[model samples]
Target: MAGNSDPLTPRAKIAVTAGKAVAAASRAAGRGSGSVIGGRVALKLDPDLLARLAQNLDVVLVSATNGKTTTTRLIAEALRAAGPVVSNALGANMPAGITSALAGGSEARYGVIEVDEKYLAGVARDTDPKCIALLNLSRDQLDRAAETRMLAENWREGLAGSKAVIVANADDPLVVWAASSSANVIWVAAGQMWKDDAWSCPSCGGVMQRPGDDWFCGECGFRRPTPSWALSGDHVLDPHGSAWPIHLQLPGRANKANAASSAAVAAVFGVPPQVALERMYQVQAVAGRYDVVQFQGRDLRLLLAKNPAGWLETFSLIDPPPTPVILSVNARGADGTDTSWLWDVDYTRLTGHPICVIGDRKLDLAVRLEVANQQFQVCENLDQAVQLCPPGRIEVIANYTAFQDLRRRVGN
Candidate 1:
């Protein structure tokens, strides 16, 4: 038992017990995906299961196109100062996953949940979170999610009725527009590396102008809000111009921005930036983001890049020129059946580097690289690719299912 026992109705209690049984059976069958199916069954048996579990809980809901899982993990770590915080540790962002996390941690009152962009409003309605953090929005799984602008518009309407204090990215035009109508908002300039999805104003359907570091609509008055908290390189800057240096075991500017966004949300609950940033530095790996493991007599660092925006940021973190890198991709159900998004990523950035292409979509990725005028070697498997790399740490970047396959092989 983890918070006080939830005050669930007798029927809801039966549903929870049944779901727990299903979860245990799934784990026993070597399908330990952390309550996904079990939670789904419970919710089907009782559609109001989440609302019941979330009672008397101070919950924080985090949503973004990228960095939702990592940001949720970072915020959970920082929120430890408040009390035990329950979260979807398995990268499950939907209602079932949220239910699983809540049911699994029955004794924890404080909670944080990473929500998929399209499902945020639904989950928020059920959970009634105390705070909502909006990171950057970009085109992801376009086959399934369609356009980023459409998603932002949905958020704007859905969030209008929410009472939660919103912590939003001031640099992202989409994020600014989504949370503009919130009753209370804490804006943070965590930086946006992907701007293709935010080129237009969602409000007026007009082109936006970026002068210096700020963006404003030419037709509408919508613009990038001045952040109460901003990130300056590795430093977290305050509204008064004072700054605190942030250290992270994870690499890249995107992660620094993720940390800054999490820190901003933590401040709303009385956790200071210095304390939050200190705890964040201790996170070397969130899920499979920056995990180094030995496989096939070679050490490898695992990084997940699901879409174009993610690949751009991951490539930026890789060392330049001839560093042995392994890029893997798959078009499984979890990775979206449409592999066309591969063409959207800038694979040319790795032109001069030694890259070994592997996975189910290896042919698709290879074709993309070839069309981009980049040179790469095709490998039969992950172990073979790792063996081809020079001795020592080989950076392995993989999409959804491909990364999971590697993790299982490495016993991670």
Candidate 2:
């Protein structure tokens, strides 16, 4: 006690922490240990021991410009129809993140995660997944993710030696390039003629016609082989519906694409197409994608906007701008470090006055609306926004993490 010294230095503390974490995890694996959330266990975990319990562990990984969350979640559920699975339900797909998630789930025969674009290389190195699913790519988060194609190139390098069966969207130009070098790549084509896929030659930027549902570049012989799995459709069901004769927890055009992605992966696991499609049709929408909330006097459409692709998908689902809408930006730099992505979102698609601006960067959204020439109000606080919401009807659009916080505020 005579001389006070730093009891544990930073390096020592890290070693001690990792040791404790691993020991705790090892103990937690044999027993189902979890914390309470929204008054439910919410998720289940068991760590490495639980993963050791699984049989024939054929892990699947999904990466995308859009659809990662909904797609991965759907794949997890579909796999449930087949067997046990270990997955980070919250899309934590980094190296340390995946290690923690996989180590936590001890009772799984498969592992899956919705990986971030920039973190793919690290996660792939750690997991070496057997079945990989890749979706589309688009310009998003230029500050953090340089460019979508650059990220896609990195994905190819990460998957080069992986002994995993790969599923790719054949209509995407970048996806075509990524799958070119992989021997186990299973190409899937979803028949969305909309602007989602690459219909033009990458070299000349001229429209490359699809001859018989197969894509080829007219400007150059740069083309890819046909996909192993495919879907043909227009205007798939919207997730906003309360329930369907065929229940899909996640619904919408992008969701349809999400379902197709899950189906492709499930098929790779030897799950029959009929079984996967049935699973897709049977799920209902989750909390985020166009989740509709019924408040005391208001009907709110809670649309999630994180990246440009997500917002674009949201806009595609909405017929027209819902009047008297409220937009929330979690500009605290908490959810995402950058709030400038608002520049990429086409807010002009909105046609009416925004009743409230919610979140720490409330003014940022308010000002952005002004710059976009859209009329809006600044409630500043979320409660104030809730109070000011049009009594009968209103739309509320929130970004990733903000959406959950907003839902809790409205008791949704």
Candidate 3:
């Protein structure tokens, strides 16, 4: 009587082998279930599968171009302050991935997932979260995202009908204004990044001027206001002294914004303001995101920049240590959808130093590095980059997907 509980004996293996082969042959013949969950052949399940699953949970969906992972993790932590929780901690965010993750928690009281922008509307319809967190949007992969406007457009459409109590970023007019239409919006603001919210309006195609920290259209009069949950600059802590006391284990302005957005959302979730401030102060830099590690006995800070804002933010956090740098990029999907954003990054900060540029796209990155006329060591592969870097610790900034993959290979 072999079943899930019984250990597989040799005879059991011999018996199950036939069934496994039958399923495999059927799958190879295009007539079997694509995947197995709960011991069922599940190739062509109905679209309402997620709805069926979520009937048992209080789902929370988080989506944004930046800070979704960190913010979602912390929000789940705070939410657990409310009750039992289940989530996709490894970040498989596609609808299928969410379905896979949501499958395991038939008994959990709550579910929180970070959904990609492309899949948010579909997931929202299926999961029907009672609470939603919308972080700010910025230019990321124009090739895949098409353009900033399209990404924004998709978000607006996804969030249009949600009855969830929305936790939104006020500083970003795009997120704030889109979510503002919700009946009960929980506003969140970070310290002002633009001294003025002035900009060229993507809507109505007009010029925008900052009237205080909020933006107002000079022509069409489309306005973006601040959020309901915000931290006074006084609570944030940074030696750079920008009025906010935000402490990033990884230093930079964009990180401050990330932390602020996370904090503001935490407040709306019912984490008291003081406790939210304390928890944010406790934020540790995820490896490769301004991660400081010891490499070859040298102190190395790893900053991964996948977009224009990420690159700009990494530059802000560069309180470089004694060892120089290993600025790496790659042709891998993780490096970027397109490397054009590299042009927007100010790489002049590394000029005149002996820097190493490593990746499959070394020549491409070298071309960008050369424009600054910086003397750098170029390696087309990771083994070579690690070889050239001195025995002492150093700082490394990687872009896009290459950040985590490169650091895991090099840091050890």
Which is the winner by lDDT between candidate 1 and candidate 2? 1
Best by lDDT: 1
Q: Cα deviation of 147 in candidate 1 (Å)?
A: 1.2
What are the per-residue Cα lDDT tens digits for candidate 2 across 290-387? 66777665677788777766776676665344456777777444356577777777778775644577776787777888888887778856656767
Supply the global lDDT for candidate 1. Answer: 0.87
Tens digits of lDDT, candidate 1, 1-412: 1246556998888888888899989989998674889899899989999999988578999999899999999999998877788999778888898898888777676789999999988888998888999998887775688588888888888999798989999999988988987888999999888777888888898999988788999897988888899989889986677798889998999989988888888888888888999998878898877898877777788999988899999999987777789999988888888998887888888887888999998999999999999878899998788777876578899998999998998999
Candidate 3, poorest ten consecutive residues by summed lDDT: 34-43
Backbone clash pairs in model 2 (N, Cα, C under 3 Å; residues 3+ apart or in different chains), count? 19
Residue 153: error of model 1 in Å?
1.0
Candidate with top TM-score is 1
The full ranking of all candidates by TM-score, starting with the best, is: 1, 3, 2
The C-alpha RMSD of each candidate to the native structure, in angstroms, is: 1.9, 9.7, 7.9
User: Which ranges in model 1 have alpha carbons more than 4 Å from their true place?
Assistant: 1-5
- Alpha-carbon error at 56 in model 3, in Å? 2.9
lDDT by residue (tens digit), candidate 3, 1-412:
1012323344433423443444466558765232232112221234455565566677778887766766666656655655666776656577655665555554566787888877777788877787778876677765666455566666677778678878777667667656755787766665434221225665665776776666777897777654455555444322232334555453555555556565555545555544554555555654335566765555667777666665665665665543567777765654445777677667887664458887656787889888977778877665566667766656677765567666666553
